[model samples]
Target: MPRSPYMHLPPAARSRTVTAVLGPTNTGKTHLAIERMLAHKSGLIGLPLRLLAREVYGRIEERAGTDAVALITGEEKIIPKAPRYWVSTVEAMPLDLETDFVAIDEVQLAGDLDRGHVFTDRLLNLRGQSETLLLGAATVRPLLEKLLPGLNVVTRPRMSVLTYAGSKKVSRLPPRSAIVAFSADEVYGIAELIRRQRGGAAVVLGSLSPRTRNAQVELFQNGDVEHLVATDAIGMGLNLDVDHVAFAGNRKYDGYQYRQLTAAEMGQIAGRAGRHTRDGTFGVTGRVDPLDDELVEQIENHHFNSLKVLQWRNSRLDFASSASLRASLDVVPREDGLARAPIGDDINALEHLLRDSGISTMAKGPKAVELLWDVCQVPDYRKIAPANHAELLSTIYTHLMQDGAIADDWFTRQLAFADRADGDIDTLANRIAHIRTWTYVANRPDWLADPAHWQGVTRGIEDKLSDALHDRLTKRFVDRRTSVLMRRLRENAMLEAEITSSGDVLVEGQHIGNLLGFRFAPDAAAEGPDGKTVRAAAQKALATEIE
Candidate 1:
């Protein structure tokens, strides 16, 4: 059998020291990292997206065997007793591990203003003897090499082009084939088009949950999906095989208006094609805008291939204070400020005024609002905030009540109400009615007390449910023959039938179901148009076997 592509890597690349796998897209860097883990016996893989992490876990299991792999993303954890291969999001990864290797799949995230520091710190200082591999798009490849001088650099120039359909004047796609757009509206628009024109490809947004994103990938891979309408969330380690990648939109959210894609971004996404063996058709397609021919030319020329150093700085609202827009500005020079009066009300406002006074360089316009949400969720946000923090606290509290633990939601709501009489009215007014409705359905005495397994319904509702309902439901379910059979199946309980040496038993096999009188409905699926019923098939199979 042929060796896997991941199996053969140079010793220099797999040493017990930091190693960098910097390159353009589709260079198979992630696979290389996995191979290093396999050879070294243990390692942790960090991916930016949960879907990618989950997929990595599945692949590792397929290669290493069940229970040999573990997944630790935000959504779920399959922690093996002695897991040798762990897959997780960068943030979810344990701060310290005794493993032989740590690989950050999309290391260029070091340029992100929000979570970039985590990856940068990891690249700069990881304590174990284990090796580290930083994989990312080509634009930031030089930055990693500069930061880590001992790092090994590998560059795989993209071999594919992005192609698309539309008139030249339509510069940005309405959302067709992986179009790059800045706003949520553009993504939705593109998604709608794919749904109508190309048989409905999955819409990929940065904020979508891991489970939902994986479902989309599955649909695409299984041929049920046509296009993948996505944001930059798919730019990194996602493995979506496509014959043609079209930039449906040009404007990327750079803090203000949706602007055109930088050469680096165009190159980053184009690299996704011709991945593994590289014998496929991959190209870039986009609408041409006469106003921005220079950008188009740069994209076509691949001038963005040269490594450019970028700092992680972006504008953001100062949720710390009462004033919103003034949060992320700069201060004016002493000489200029001395001649003028105090600029703005708060620090944020002053900072913005300083920008007007030519005090600071204009950074990327805080392109990602999702980053703020994640940061706010951090337990330390309170420690970072200034006074008058109620409104910010309220916003964070609302989000938690919706997405966090149910108990936490109830506790926070109660705490909010206790804090102030107005707090209760404000909190209740802003809250979605569905959350309360769901709470009611989830917590009703009859529902809770019912004998349903309940685990699938919600994990934390068990204690809150009425004991009486639980007992009643349990008894009813346990008494059912079907439920009993399912339990037996789950337990892998074997059925032992006794027989005489002459083949005449205490009871003949021919009348087995008659004794039990239970139908083994093998075809207990939906009714089909062929006129054959699943229950009938099950009955026939049971009858044939027994007779």
Candidate 2:
């Protein structure tokens, strides 16, 4: 038998009481982990998504107070003096931080092709001083046990029933439903249809800035929108008041290829439907075919095939030189059920930079090589192309190595390009992505000459862009007059009406038409169902006022 890669686990770490809280979504596993972390004097928790990390940070802050909690993600960092609790994205979690308790959500992601290596590394190497909790689906149980001996495993039942409601059209999905799609184009298309048919839908995509995503979610949660159009981003523990999940498309491009979602992946997203003790349903919509009976049974039962192997990468890098660094990263794992991950964005960026003779010469020593590796980790948020992203990375690396830090003027110029708030929805979203790249740069310690000042400047710009993007999305996909009237009608609330002296009729502060004597004329633009909706609402309100 081959020796284990985790043989380096210290005696203390090996002895810590590590618990695996395995369950489907809405089983309150995250809630339990948070409670456990708060019980300790100091603790750290790593979540799968920056959005989830932000959500958890807010919850922890509300309980532990702002001064005691710190939030760290690639693009955002908020650390307070003498912080007792730390919340971070899995990629951003500081493994060196010594805490009494440590918890990692979505442990099953260790099998993910792209990001699994990081999760696998955390699973094996990161341990709390006293207690550690691994929270994820029950499918991870077999793998967790094989990896960690003497692991305490607890399974929780779903709090509510998950049923298969079969297929439904986008226009027919229930209120408070979330229509899940795999691509931005699909999401936008569905949202547009819902706006035409069901008033509007809040949009949530992995690409949206956390601020914008949250604002969009608010539109649904607060009843401004009757439905939500989102990608599988909602799968990563976003607690929403959703009663059903309609899959507009099941297949997704998982970094490498467009493939059907595994039963586990489907369960994760479908599981987002119900919250707490409320029941939920899942089904197909749009152009996708209906799920097979067996697959539907598996999802409804929350049963999934156990992960056979986990993606692993050599975290202990040589960094002596670029060549040594690449060699070390390619090292195979000795442990069973562990496979080397394919080249990721960071490694690709490194290879691209190494191709440049100037960069190769500068990245000579261990310090320089390590800095190069760190620079490679900057994510390609813009997604323009690999070459374009590599060019940006090269510029940043050259600036960092030539000067002690990136030149303020150059950084400011890059930021200035994305600072403008004028753009259509796609344009604004693109600008938000551009600003996010600079935000990540600003968050990197020592990357900028004045990290604190740049952090503030970049964050302000991101917030501004996020707000602009949100407004653009709402304007493009939402009809506020229709949504307000429909919601009011649903609630059986009496509508307010006013008539101007010039005979203009208004309902709920929205101009419906002109009242000429006994005739109520709707606006020329109101046609189809919209015209009927306006007439119905107008008649209800005017009956009380005109009489």
Model 1: weakest 10-residue lDDT segment is 333-342
Predicted candidate 2 versus true structure: per-residue lDDT over 408-484, tens digit per residue: 99988999999999978888889888988998999999998789999899899889989999998999889887888
Query: How many clashes in each structure?
Result: 24, 0
What candidate 2 gets wrong by more than 4 Å, as runs, is 1-15
**Local distance difference test, candidate 1:** 0.47
Residue 545, candidate 1: alpha-carbon lDDT: 45
Using TM-score, give the best candidate's number.
2
**Candidate 1 on 252-366: residue-level lDDT in tens?**
6653355666667765665554456543222333343432455455544445654343322222234343223333333221211011112212333233323332212221133
lDDT of each: 0.47, 0.90
